[model samples]
Target: MKDRVLDLVFLVGVLFKGLDGLAELVTGVLLLFVTPAKLHQAAGAATAGERAEDPHDLIANLIVHGVAHLQHGSIVFAALYLLVHGVVKLAIVIALLIGSRGIYPWAMGALGAFLIFQVYELVTNPSIAVAILTVFDAIIIWLTWREWRRGRELRTTWRGTVAWVFRRRVAT
Candidate 1:
């Protein structure tokens, strides 16, 4: 029963990661074609009503302020970052979904590294989205570790059972 709940949570987290990866990939491709000026204009247009209603709207202001200072180099860097992040995430999701034991450590390591990076980002930028992502990554990391330990235990038990059976057969 406990394992069932963990499994459900893990499955939900993996699906979220897959969806986030696909969105990142699409956004990366879009970034390659869109100019900073265009992004700024779009942000302004989208937030026009919100800004009018409440000029200090946090989300709307953040979006507008962020794009207002955008640069060409920033766009390139963002695109590359998103593309790489998306690919890694999707690969991890695929392996885990397929029940690949070898990938358990690899996925945990990769996500641990990313979690560290996200922490740094959160400290430096202090954005709500980054904070949320950092927390989510932490949760995923915990789940992965738990699952890995569970898998290792199962493998160990299976091996012990097999060896015991082999010894009994030989004695008989």
Candidate 2:
């Protein structure tokens, strides 16, 4: 029973990690196309007319708009990420409490690293936040790979309900 509970917790963590990875991939792809100027406008920054007199006004205007849009999108994304992150954290914590535990150290280390990244971003340049997010994306990808490997191993070793459902779908 305890093992079953741990398996469920692990599955939830894997799902959340996969979702996070996909979100990061989508965001990165979007960034490749959406210019800073358009982001700034989306964020409610000043229009081009507001700062037309300065020689570098065009660049500044673009930055302002881009930053604004980035900030706005960041807020929404951050909130959703935090909620899922908290749930994953809680699942791990609970699993540890139940003694299905060897992952406490890793969990703590990952949380600490993320917290430090956030603090550093808050104190320094906002642009640095993008780099921190990229690091997280890498972490999520790694987690996703590990989870997928575990799931694959389980499929070959056990005739679980999940495998049964997947097999049925594939047959149809």
lDDT of 2 by residue, 1-172 (tens): 4444444444555456546645655555555556556666554444455565673666666666557556546745654565555555555445444544345446545656666666677667565656666465455435434544454432322245356557767999
Q: Which regions in candidate 1 have their CA more than 4 angstroms from the true location?
A: 152-172
lDDT of 2: 0.53
Please, what are the lDDT tens digits per residue for candidate 1 over residues 102-150?
8878888888888888889988878788889988888888988887887
Q: Highest lDDT, which number?
A: 1
Compared with the true structure, all predictions reach lDDT values of 0.82, 0.53
RMSD to true structure for each model, in Å: 9.6, 13.2
Clashes of each: 0, 4
Task: Give the least accurate 10-residue stretch of model 1, judged by summed lDDT.
Answer: 152-161
The model with the greatest TM-score is: 1
At residue 152, candidate 2 shows an lDDT of 41
